[model samples]
Each structure stands twice: as structure tokens, then as C-alpha cells.
Target: MDEALWAFGRASGVVALVLFTASIVLGIITRSGRLLPGLPRFSVTLVHRNVSLVGSVFILLHVGSLLLDSYAKLNVTDIVVPFIGSYKPFWQGLGTVAVDLLIAIIVTSLLRQRLGVKVFRAVHWFSYAMWPIAMVHAIGNGTDGTSSWFLLLAAVCTLAVGTALIWRLSSRFVESARLRQESV
Candidate 1:
């Protein structure tokens, strides 16, 4: 059961990172008017937003519980500080960075109206940095990281995230061109 829990936690981490990355990528290129062609007309962004939130919650819970499990031998500093874990410092630091980035992103999101668009967008760009940190954390620390099943799962996530990013960029390009055409 503990192994299963750990594995599940790792899975949630992968999913969360992927969704966050994909959503940011999508947001950047939404105006491109390419693949996810319906992105503008639908609730794609909303779904991405909500999903990332839920995934983050699950990941936090998982990491918190692991620290409490005794079997894991995690220190409080392990969670609060980056790269201070007994098992692996470099890989574990990635988790800490991700946590910090997530907090910043969420805090800024909550204050988006007050901060305004420019500041919010600048802070929000942290999502790109956070995702790869998370991916490295999961791939390096995950108990099942080397397993075929987990590898396949990670690969699929990478593909999905990549596709969404491409779609967003293209859509943004298309939208920009259309606007220019109309202006001319």
C-alpha cells in the first residue's frame, strides 16, 4: 500500500507538471488560430487552469504525507528548503523549486486584478520553468521512475504537453496574421 501510494504520488506529480506546462504553452499561442482551433471558443483554458490547481493539491498532499510516513525518512527541511533531502539533494531540490514557483504563480493569480496584466504575465512565465523542474524531480526521485510503465506514462505526458504548446503557438500566429490582414 505504501509503495502504491508513493507511485500514485509520483504519477500525480507527472500529471500536474504536464498540465501546467501545456496550459501555459496554450495560453501563449491561443491567438495563433491553428490546431486547438476551437481553443478561443471553448473552455480549454479554464479546464487547464482548474486541472493544474487540482493536480497541485494532490501533489502537495502526497509530498506532505511522505514526510510524515517515517518510512521515507524525510526531514522538514526537505520540504521547506530546496535540495536538502537525505536520499538525493540535486533531484529533490527540483521539487522545492517547483513548490516555490507554484506558490508564486497561485499568489499572483489571486492578485491578478490588483497586479494588472503586465506584472501578472511576467510572474506567470514561471510556469515554464516550474514544469521542467517538476519533470526532473519526478523522473529522478520517483520510485517507479525507471519502470517501463512509468516511463511510458511520462512519455505520453510529454507528447500531450508538446502538442498543446504547438497548437497554442500556431493559433496565436494565425490570430496575429488575421489582425494584421484586417488592418491592412
Candidate 2:
């Protein structure tokens, strides 16, 4: 049962990371106002939202399973508060902080209309912080953090997201340049 729980937690964590990476890339694409082939602009947003929701579910599973597993030694407080865990407190705390940021992002998104776009957008920017924090948590705390396969997977995820981020920023820069030329 312990082995089963451990495996479930690890698998769920990996799945959550992949889903989060996809959502991040999709989010950049959505913000850039780019249409995926055969898909409308809104569809990209919908896909991003769905991916994020699924990722959140996986994160829940990861945390719940680990909590159940005696090996992890994760208490409720450790999961909620940062840097208080008996095991690798710093790494575990990163996960806690990431989860906190995710909660804030989710709550603000749900209340977007009521809170206004400015509030929602402000909170959403936390995602940029959340992703790296989560990644670091996985690398520092995961059982397979030192394994070659896990490193490969992490590298791939980083590359994909990094490429997408560069594209997003470059596009913004180009647009600003174009706007300046027009104004002048």
C-alpha cells in the first residue's frame, strides 16, 4: 500500500508538471493572440483553462497521496505553511509556496468578473513565479530528482517553456517597436 501510494504520488506529480507546462505555453500563445491551426482564438483560451484545471487535479492527487504515504512525512501544516517540514524543508516549502500561488490565481480567476480584470490579471501574473517554484520543488524534493530520466524530462520541459517565453517577449517587443514607428 505504501509503495502504491508512493508510485501514485510520483506519477501524479509528473503528470501535473507536464500539464502545467502545456498550460503555460498555451497561455503565452493565447496572450500573443495567435490562433492554432484549425482552432479559434477562444479555443486556445479554453484549452489552456482545461489543461490548468486538469493539472490542478493532478496536483491534488500528488499531495494527497504523499500525505497518505508514511515515507513523505507531510503533515497538514507542512503542506499549508512553508519551510516547516521535517524532510527537506526548503524544497517542500517551495511546493507549499507554489500551491499557495496557484490557489490565489485560481481564486482570482473564478472571481474575475466580480474582482475586475485588473485584479485577475495581477494575480494571474503570479503563474510565472509559480511554475519555476514548482519545478524547483520537484527537482529538489522528488525521489527521482537525481535520476537521468527525470533530469531529461525536466530539461525538456524547461526548454519548451523557455522557447515559448522568448517568443512571447520578442513578439511584444516587435509590436511595441511597430507602434513607435507608427506614432512617429
Candidate 3:
């Protein structure tokens, strides 16, 4: 039973990380106002939203399995509050922080109509912070952290996100410069 729980936790965590990576990339694309080759603009937004929701579910499974596994030593408090877990406190705390930020993002999204776009976007920006925190937590605290495969996975995820972020920023800068030149 313990082994099963441990396996479940690890697998779920990996899946969650992959899903979140997809969400981040898709979100950057959506924000850039460029339609994917076969996907409409709205389709890209929908895909991003669905990927994020699925990633949250995987995150819940990962945490729940860890809580059940004696090896993880996680309690309810450890999930909600940061830096107080008996096992890998700092790394676990980073995961906790990521979860907290995720909660805020989810809540704001659900209430977007009532809360207003500004509030939703402000909270959504937490994704930038949340993704890296979660990645560090996975690599630092995971049992297979030092394994070659895991490291490769982490590197791939990093490269994908880094590329997307660079594209987003550079495009935005170019657009700004173009607007300034036109105005001049």
C-alpha cells in the first residue's frame, strides 16, 4: 500500500507538471494574439483553460497521495501552510506556496464575471511565480530528483517555457516600438 501510494504520488506530480507546462505555453500563445496553425483564437484559449483545470486535478492527486504515504509525512497543515512539513520542509513549502497561488488563480477565474478582468488578470499573473516554484519543489523534493530521466524532463520543461516567454516578451517589445514609430 505504501509503495502504491508513493508511485501514485510521483506519477501524478509528473503529470501535473507536464500539464502545467502545456498550460503555460498555450497561455503565452493566447496572449500573443496569434492563432495556432489549426486552432482558432478561441480554441487556443479553451485549450489553455482545460489544460490548467486538468493540471489542478493532477496536483490534487499528487498531494493527496503524498498525504496518504507515510514516506511523505505530509499533513493537512502542510498542504495549506508553507514551510512546516516534517519531510523536505523548504521544498514542500514551495509546493504549498504554489498551491496557494493556484487557489487564488482558480477562485479569481471562476468569479471573473463578478470580480472584473483586472482582478482576474492580477491573480492570474501568479502563474509565472507558481510554475517555477512548483518546478523547484519537484526537482528538489522529489525522490527521483537526481535521476537522469527526471532531470531531462525538468530541462525540457524549462526550455519550452523559456522559449515561450522570450517570444512573448520580444513580440510585445516589437509591437511597442512599432506603435512609437507610427506615432512619431
Candidate 4:
């Protein structure tokens, strides 16, 4: 029973990370062409936005379950603060980092208008950081890290997130050059 619950927790964590990656991809796709420069990026942005919201919800559930699980050995404070989890402070600290990143993402998203375009866009980039942090937490601290199913899940999660992030970053240079040439 305990193992099953742990597996579920890990699965939810992976699900949340996958959703976050989708959101990042769609966001880059949907942004303004002149400002963002992309191939058919808008619709995906909406999908990304919606999916990210759902991902956040799932992540909340994942954290909640971890705290609830007797085997996890995580206190409520451990979930919030970094390097404080007694079970495995170094690796679990990834969760702390992720939580902070999530809070920043949420705040900026909510106050996007107030934050303005430059600040909002800048902070938005950090969402990319959050995915890896969460992934590290799952892999390093999760009990199922060595399990075959968990390994597969981690691979998919990492691939999806890494691809989206790489595309987003790489396309920036290409887009900039394209815009520059067009202007010339």
C-alpha cells in the first residue's frame, strides 16, 4: 500500500512536469511574431497556459500527498523551506527550490499587467527553471527513482522538458536574425 502511494506521488510529480513543459512550448509558439518570431506559435500558447494551470494543481496534489505519506518523513515546513527536509536535505532541497520558483511564476502570472511586459517576460523565463528543479526533486529524493517504471517516467519527463526549453532558447537567436534581416 505504501509503495503504491509513493508510486502515485511520483507519477503525479512527473505529470505536473510534463504539463509545465507543454505550457512553455505553447507559450513560445503563441507569442507575437515580431516580438517572439515563431511558426504557428499562438494556439499552442493557449494550450500551454491552460495546461500549466492544471499542472500547478497537480503539483499541489503531489506535494500534499508526499506530506501525508508516512514513509516520506517530510514535515509541513520541510515542504516549504529549502535544505530543511530531514529525510534527504540535499536532494529534497530541489523541491524547496521548485516551490519558490512556482510561487514566483504564479505571482508574475497573476500580476502580469502590473509587472509590465519587460518584467513579466523576464520572470516568465524562470518557469523553465522550475521544471528541472521539480524533476531533480522527483529523481533524487523520490523512493521510486530506481524502479523501471519510474526511470521511464523520468526519461519522458526530461526529454519533453529539455526539448521545449532548448527549442525556446535556440529559436530566440534564429528569430532575432530573421527579424534583423527583414528590417534590413
Candidate 5:
């Protein structure tokens, strides 16, 4: 039973990482108004939202399974509060912090209309922090973190998100430059 729980925890954690990477990349692409052939902007936006929801579900499963696993010995407090766990406290705490940030982002998005766009946008920016924290936690705390497969997966995810971010930033820079040229 303990082994099963451990395996489930590891699998769920990996799945959550993959899904989160996809969500981040999709979000950047959506912001840039980039779409695959035959897909509209709204479709990209919908996919980004849905991917985030699914990634959150996987993250919950990852936390739950690890908490239940006797080998991990994670208490509920460890899952919520940062830096107090018996196990690899620093890395685990980073994961906890990322989870907290995700919760804030999700709640703010849900209340976006009431809170207004500026508030939601400000909260959403935390995702940039959350993703790298989560990645570091995974690489630092994961048992298979040094394995070839996990390294490849991490590399691919990093490359995809990095490319999207570069594209998004460069496009924005070009737009600002164009505006400045016209103004001048």
C-alpha cells in the first residue's frame, strides 16, 4: 500500500509538471494571439484555461498521494505551510509556496469581475514566479530528478516555455519600438 501510494505520488507529480508547463506555454501563446492552423484565439484561450485546471487537479493528487504515503510522512500542515516539513524542508517548502501562489491566482481569476482586471492581472503575474519555484522543487526533491528521462522531460519543458516567453517578449518590444517610431 505504501509503495502504491509512493508511485502514485511520483506519477502525479510528473504529470502535474508536464501539464503546468503546457498551461504556461499555452498562456504565453494565447497572450501573443498565436494559434495553430484552424484554431481561433478563443480556442487557444479556452485550452489554456482548461490545461491550468487539469494541472491543478494533478497537483492536488500529487500532494494528496504524498501525504498519504507513509514513506513521505507529510502532514497536512506540510502541504500548506512552508519550511516546516521533516523532509527536504527547503525544496518541499518551495512546492508549498508554489501551491499557495496557485491558489491565489485561481481564486483571483474566479473573482476577476468583482476584483477588476488590474487586480486579477497583478495576481496572475505570480504564475511566473510559481512555475520556476515548482520546477526547482521538482528537480531538487524528486527521487528521479537526476535520472535521464526526468532530465529530458525537464529540458523539453524548459525549452518550450523559454521559446514562448522569448517570442512574447520580443513581439512586445517590437510593438513598442514601432509605436515610438511612429510617435517620433
Candidate 6:
């Protein structure tokens, strides 16, 4: 029973990470208005939203399984509160913080219509922080942290997000520069 729960928790965590990475990449692509071979921007946006929702579900499963697994020894508070878990407090705390940030992002997104674009965007930016925190938490605390497969997965995720972030930021900078030149 314990082994099953442990395997489920690990698998769910990895899946969540992959989905989160895909969501971020898709979001960047959507923002850039880049259409894939057969996918339009709107389709990309839809996929991003769906992927994010699925990732969140996986995250919930990962946490729930870990909590239920006696081997992990995680309590409800450990899931909700940061830095207070009996096991691997620092790493677990990072995970908790990431989860809290994700929850905030999800809530703000759902309330985006009522909250207005400015507020929604401000909250959404927290996802940038949340992703790295999650990555670190997984690598530092995961049972398979040192495994070659896990490391490869983490590396791929990091590279994808990093490249997208650079592209997004550079494009914004170019746009701003062009605007400045036009104003001048």
C-alpha cells in the first residue's frame, strides 16, 4: 500500500511538472501570437488553459498521495503551511509556497473579469515565481532527485521555460524601443 501511494505521488508530481512546463510554453507562444502548423493562437490559448487546469489537478493528487502515504509522513498542515512540515521542512516549505502561489494565480484568473486586467495580470505574474519554486522543491526533495531520468526531465523543463522567458522579454524590449524611437 505504501509503495503504491509513493509511486502514485512521484508519478503525479512528475506529470504536474511536465504539464506546468507545457502550459507556460504554450502561454508564451500564445502571447507571441505564434501559430503552430495547424494550431491558431486561440487554440494555443485554449490548450494552455486546459493544460494548466490539468497540472493543478496533478499537483493536488501529488500532495494528497504524499499526505496519505505514511512513508512521506506529511500532515494536512504541511500541505497548506510553508516551512512547518516535520519532514524536509525547507524543501517542503518551498512546495507549500509554490502551491499557495498557484492557488492565488488560479483564483485571480477565475475572478479576472471582476478584478480587472491590471489586478489579474499582477497576480498572474506570480506564476513566474511559482514555477521555479516548484522545480527546486521537486529536485531537492524528491525521492528520485538524483536519478538520471528525473534530472533529464527537470533539465528539459528548465530549458523550455527559460528559452520562452527570454524570447518574451526580448520581444517586449524591442517593442518598447520601437515605441520610444517613434515617439522621439
Over the stretch 35-84, how does candidate 3's per-residue lDDT look in tens digits? Answer: 78988767988999999999999999999999999988899999999999
Clashing residue pairs, backbone N/CA/C < 3 A, model 4: 23-48, 26-44, 26-45, 29-41, 30-41, 30-42
Q: Write the per-residue lDDT of candidate 1 for residues 18-93, one digit (tens) a residue.
A: 6666666566544343446445534655655676677678768768767765556677778878977877788888
lDDT of each: 0.70, 0.89, 0.90, 0.74, 0.87, 0.89
TM-score: model 5 vs. ground truth: 0.91
Query: What pairs collide in candidate 2?
Result: none
Model 4, runs deviating above 4 Å: 1-5, 32-42, 171-184
lDDT by residue for model 6 (119-140), tens: 8878988989999999999998
Worst 10 residues of 3 by lDDT: 173-182
| RMSD over all Cα atoms, model 5 | 4.1
Q: Candidate 5 on 123-182: residue-level lDDT in tens?
A: 998988899899999999998877899999999999987887787678352333433453
Candidate 2 residue-wise lDDT, 1-184, digit = tens: 9999999999999899999999999988776667799998779889999999999999999999999999999989998999999999999999999999999999998998898767887899899899999999999999988799999999999998999888877835233343345333
Candidate 4 local lDDT, 65-162, one digit each (tens):
77777887778788778997878898988988898888888899889878776787788778778877777777788777678987797787677767
Give the Å error, residue 52, model 2: 0.2
Alpha carbon lDDT of residue 184, candidate 4?
41
lDDT of 1 at 182: 37
lDDT of 2: 0.89
RMSD after CA superposition, every candidate: 4.3, 3.9, 4.0, 4.7, 4.1, 3.9
Which 10 successive residues of model 1 have the least lDDT summed?
Answer: 29-38
Give residue 60's lDDT in candidate 5 (0 to 100).
Answer: 93
| Candidate with more favorable, higher lDDT: 1 or 6 | 6
Q: Rate residue 122 of model 6 by lDDT.
A: 85
Q: Model 5 clash pairs? A: none
Q: Could you tell me every candidate's TM-score relative to the true structure?
A: 0.77, 0.91, 0.92, 0.79, 0.91, 0.91
Q: Which residue pairs in model 6 clash with each other?
A: none
Q: Against the correct fold, how does model 4 do in TM-score?
A: 0.79
Clashes of each: 10, 0, 0, 6, 0, 0
